[model samples]
Target: MNASRHLLPVLVLLLVTQWAAAQINDTLPAVVEPQVDNNRVKFTSQLRPLRGVAGAPAPFYTYFWEFGDGTYSFEKEPVHLYKDTGDYPVRLWATNNYDDGKKPPTRLKKIKVEKKTMLAANTPPAFFKGGGSLEMITNQMPRPGEDMVLLLGYRNKPGSHTATVSGSVMLLYNEKQFGQNSFDLAEARSYHQEKKIGLDSLLAYAPAEEWNMPLQGTLTGEADSRGGGLFTASGGGNLPIAGKPQLKAFLKEQMEGYRQHHIWRINEVKQGEEQFMFLSLNTLPEMIKDTNAVVTISGLFIPDDPSMDVERFALDLQIVASHDPNRIMLKNRRLNYRFTGKNRENIYKVQFQNTGKGPAKRVAITVTIPGMLNTGTVELVDMKPACTWCDSAYANQSCIDTILTKDSIQFIFKNIYLPGTQQEGISDPDSTMGYVRYKLRFTKKMKKMPFTSRASIVFDKNEPIYTNRSVGRFKKGLSPGIIIGYNTIPGKKPQDILPQNYVLGFTLSEYAAYKKYFQWEIYLEKSRSYESYDGRRIGGDTMINGVGYKVEYRDQYRQQKVLSLEAVPVHFRYNINSYMAAGAGALVGVDVERSVTPVVETWIQRPNGQGLALMKGAYEKQLESFANWRGAFFADFQLGIVRAGPAAGIRFLQYINPSHQRIFLYASWKL
Candidate 1:
């Protein structure tokens, strides 16, 4: 009877196991499908990128999306835009780990995009062209007797009739004026050139004539209307000349006078060695402000022609810049910085401005103050800088600090924005308000005598502007200088890089030799407070792994006020240029530290167990010995007054780590 009972229990257990196996098999299929937001075709009239949305459910599943255009996405909800116009098939594959982790059946979608075109059937053809002062592509300023290239833009209605076009260009300055016709002697010359005629002899024989300068002048012109039938078959092109001979031949004397002062010319681009057909253009003398150049063109059509003229307009521009004195201005408000000795409160402000008609972009302002190292003589502007004539007109207002070129301070501001006329009372005077201000002091003498300062403004889009100089004469004088700086250590303990956090130091230097000599004599450093070599906690409370307990590391050192002395055996330098210097020399030093107890410390919670901060117990250890007397192969480079490179030394109780030798990178100063 006992054996039968045991057999019955075993049979039941076997049956239960079989049923559980069957249930697992039924749920193992793991069939999942991927979906998306938009699967319908759409049309756009532009050749721009397109974006699609994926609406796939996930979390337990990994998604992979294949965009038809050779791009793929692994995101659960992928979004893509096609920059090209075409038909693309997108597919998605999703896999979940619940089963064998194999990709499920792919989800495919089809999308079609329409072709893109720049012109629509309903929109008329347009033209956009001109020169400086005019919004066009040429980045140039015209010079006296220079041939000014006038840009021509053209586009016509697709089904326009053929037509003939001409233009009349004129330079009008009050009573003084110059004008030209489409079919003039210049045009005849171009016509002769097409037949391979050499006009060198004719041109040389041309008499020299004086140019008339009007008190007030204006420039005017146009093009699309001057488009001949040639543009209708394709598109319009730029022409140098565009005028008709309308004034009667009886006015030949006046025309001759105008022709003598101003002439028409043609410019051509070349492919390989083949020169392109000459494009009609105009030549003008470098006229000053109040003078304007004018142009006018017309499009004429005949019945039954496939192309016709449909526009007419005029272009006029007033010349404002001059070849002699460009529009940039500079001045130093402090005038001449007079000093009695090697040191002085060399304080001043420099102002720069763009007085031209256009905004200056990518302006590089360089201020050269020879004989000054940024580290010593240059102090932080102290507080927020004062601006007498600026209100966010310029972006990137920060200075480049010590620019290495010629001991100069340089920085570049992008897009010096000019307010439009619509902007309130800011007229020409208000425009002069943008200038740079710097305040500094010089405590040490320079390698050369007589301090001379000058500034320059460079532009990426225009000619550079220069400032007049301020020269300072030396008097038998002297004054003190101050400098504060920082350097950081990388290690398991005290991982801080703040100037105050790493080092607090003071250095005094003197100009001992001729005007060509200077040396750093005294240096003092104070160690900053830091947690023990461990970071888990600071002060009385610290951290422990996997536990809610506290431990603390304390800051300690013996005779912490460490001092050092340096001598200048042979001081020399290699000049890379008028603006940069490189130098190296042997320096030996002895660390001064009084005998005292050196300790490592920690803290623990008190027996009262009140609060971590309320009660504490302190622990410390005294070291057996510490090494001293250290120095290394040191190299120094001066970019103007800015310095860089590595160094080595020793501190009391702790020999300066050779690895930490780079701290000198933050230790140089000129004053």
Candidate 2:
């Protein structure tokens, strides 16, 4: 029986280990199944069945296929026709939505086209017609410990009608505001003869008057309808144009906001011609764990021509647990608790894609509005498949209409044509996607708690496809507090010779947490006491064999000073309201320094028998010690503002070994 008891736990652990290994093996990467005919190839994927997540939509797979010839598609089984006969490498990313398992792994395959059967007449159109002079887009959202590709598209549009230009492009990542790096640049691929350069070399190309203000305004002040700015509250901000502050000034400003950056020097770019650069960024394993959080990667485009104005662009991507095309996001998911209040504006974006095999004439999106937000303040900031607002004058043209309920908002795209990803003759994946962005303000006196919202997308009369929940959380800010207290031992009267104890300390805890939080504290305490004792006289006025009687006496006085380093290692607190709170925790302390001074006097009677007393000995001594350990348990109550600012409280502490207790009256201010 004893042997079996000892072996049972080990057997159970082994079983668990095997089960976990089996679970991991069940989620292998998808296999690429390709069929080829001359230059035309049809690709299919065989993916492991998804393990569905509880309470989530039905499990499904989303595909992102990259053809070797600088082209890609979002179709499940894309059929491509190669114009040139060469070896092409193809890759696929199979995203399992509503699945409990990790995303399926992918393998790159090299497809060789030896014979050409058809003409290359249906070439895709060129980019940079509408995506501004400098723009960026990512293949997919970032997943921790995974890799993602960012494509930077730039054009030579130096307004002076210059035929050719040479300039540099910079990619900035890993915002310094976050404590840990979110991404590391693994590789950068450039087809053009772009050379990597240092920061100083890039700054050397700046124009004169570097400190002048930009023609474009600040990115943090308002939401940009163009969706190309450092998004703070809303989804967009002004994409700045360095009209006056030259290229060097902009680079200096960007350096302060980002932790790491990479610059590339372009030798030449012809007018109206566009160039592309692809960066492979590996999401660091220690990236921030907020799955719904958003991280930004900014870019700058500078022309060597002194007259050309520099341009800036930014792209925001959410850190996702899984890649899902239909999703909603708050651009600024983590907010400062101090500034989040009424009149604070926030932007919410809903994105939907058509996955069916045909186009939809109408699409409707309904979103749940968190109670703390004021729905009356909703304003459309931007949208794709851009259309005008519905009016009486727009019955025939395509337009968007809004309907508001008490707790939800619905946006209907009417008389519109949105192509499906699997639709025939569709080559551009971007053409099948749509999004709606709107801004809202917080209600007055909202609670400082996290909020979430999701969207339900409908294509014509089909079932609603639910998106992921977008959460808005306040950054767990730090609150530093100062404590001053005076403590007295319990069961001690005014005249009972009590030690004088005074405490001065500091505390650290979550800043104004909604209800409950833990705190850690350390303090210095000084305790002083005085002690004295006297022995009664003995052998007084006694004589033996004609000798005087001898008497011995002793008296002593001592003063002690104890300086202790006190700490609270485990403290749990709960705030009942804005002004009242309670807490309980264990406190530990050690006397770092201690000192004691003693005065002793001894008296002896003379032998004359006449009782003549004289002092025989007198001495003063000092005693010292280090590291006297002690511990106590304390429960405290507070009055006044418990979250921030000033507060006063009293704590009761009971010592474990000595069976002594103390009461402390303290005042604190949390800042």
Candidate 3:
């Protein structure tokens, strides 16, 4: 038994080493193959064989194609139609999932279209479908120091007008809420005659036209609003505002919230025609390194013709450390500790992709839920590969079946055909990707600490793939407390001490911390003390004449007032339970104002006690400013809601200089 115990740790270490080694990816390359039929082209990619992960799903490659004409596609083989014949450089980025190797490097191919053979009839006109005018999308989630592409799609409403129009488009990123810039615009490729302009220029390019539109409406309706003559003039003309200040005000309002802005002026966009603009953004090294954190980029389209409505779109992406197909993210990764309780809701999203050569008939995603979150409060917020919830009516149809366990939730995609990344004739990589977002409320009683959850994805009958841990942490919220205390020296008589010390102060600490944390205290103290002694007779003082001298007596009275500023700069505290806590630290204080009042009187009496004389007020009061400095070490214990809110404590302080001790009783309330 002893030998087995000694070898157990060694065996566990070896297993961990082997598992880590299996996760290292190899460097593979993908080559792009394009077939050109004059202005039309059919694009394909030749990929190297993917190294399969042991006991894992079959390895495959997911492709992102940029056709260099401000147009792109996620399909395995996409057919693109060029408006004009030219030499365009096409780029391919392929990611290998379920493979024991690095992502394949990007490949670039230049295709020259010298002849015109295919007409506009070969192109699909539903690029911006379902009445959507502006759309923003990204090729991949951002990884620090990696490059990603963002495509902005804009189109005029199909039946709005038949004439050409000019517009300005703005791309806003690097939200000021984050500490550093997440992405840098490396390059922009616009096939159309789109000219980059400054914010001032974009705002200044106002055309002389306007259309009446009501401002009082829902936010969603305003975003998708088509121009209408809501308010008419005397001659049935639409009410018009000079220079469209409302639109400009809207644009300026958005600009203030972001740190980086890129604006482009697009010219001569015909109605019912879709336009594209591609931007290559490089994730900076200083980007937020939290893998579960999310960032957003917004795109705005404003046509010069005020008759057309404006459009705005936002694209949100998660920051990643690797090109992993299966991952989990927490939308509220950082929460305010003070405001977190049973009523707070946290949203988590789990995304998975089938990277096999064949389609997956059944996909199951098992997520481990943190204990702080209430499992009963799980509600599905959104999902991809959209389907109805599984029930008796949908028993044999495509649906998502959910099973709740004590500590986990399993979402099973049943009776569905989800395409694989390497499946033949599958062009869109998005077809292989699926995700589920669910919101969970916190438990009634929970600790102010970070929690993490992860997902295990299984495709068909293959091995499970584990994703990164999605972490949710509480922000170190501050707790400001009002402190009132009384100080006294023990083992002192009333006449010897006359202790009347009072202290008023405040404390600062982490709000509702479950574990050990530090706190700071500052205090202002005022103490008034009085001491007096009756006259005492001593041996007769020598008289000036060398004869019998009269008896001499003296009377003394003293009073002191001290105002001090005390600070406890270093104090460590730990909660023993919900109501009890212990702490110990040192403090230094200075008596900013000190005043002393001394009164002495002398009397002379005859030796026979026949005569007596009195002297009063011989010595007056003396005051000093900024006189004394003191330091002490202290330990304290608190009771009654020690973690937060109201608490009362008793402290013992040992003064270093003069070697004295004081007892302090205090009450505090954390706000």
Candidate 1 lDDT for residue 439: 48
What is the clash count for each candidate, in the order shown? Answer: 43, 2, 7
List residue ranges in candidate 3 displaced over 4 A: 1-60, 75-85, 96-113, 118-130, 159-165, 206-245, 305-308, 492-499, 527-561, 595-627
Per-residue C-alpha lDDT of model 2 across residues 50-107, encoded as one tens digit per residue = 7777665567676767677766555677888887899987878776666777777767
Q: lDDT per model, in order?
A: 0.34, 0.75, 0.74
Q: Which residue pairs does candidate 2 place in steric collision? A: 224-236, 548-607
Task: Please give each candidate's TM-score.
Answer: 0.20, 0.80, 0.79
Model 1, residue 223: C-alpha shift (Å): 48
Better of 1 and 2 by lDDT: 2
What is the full ranking by TM-score, best candidate first? 2, 3, 1
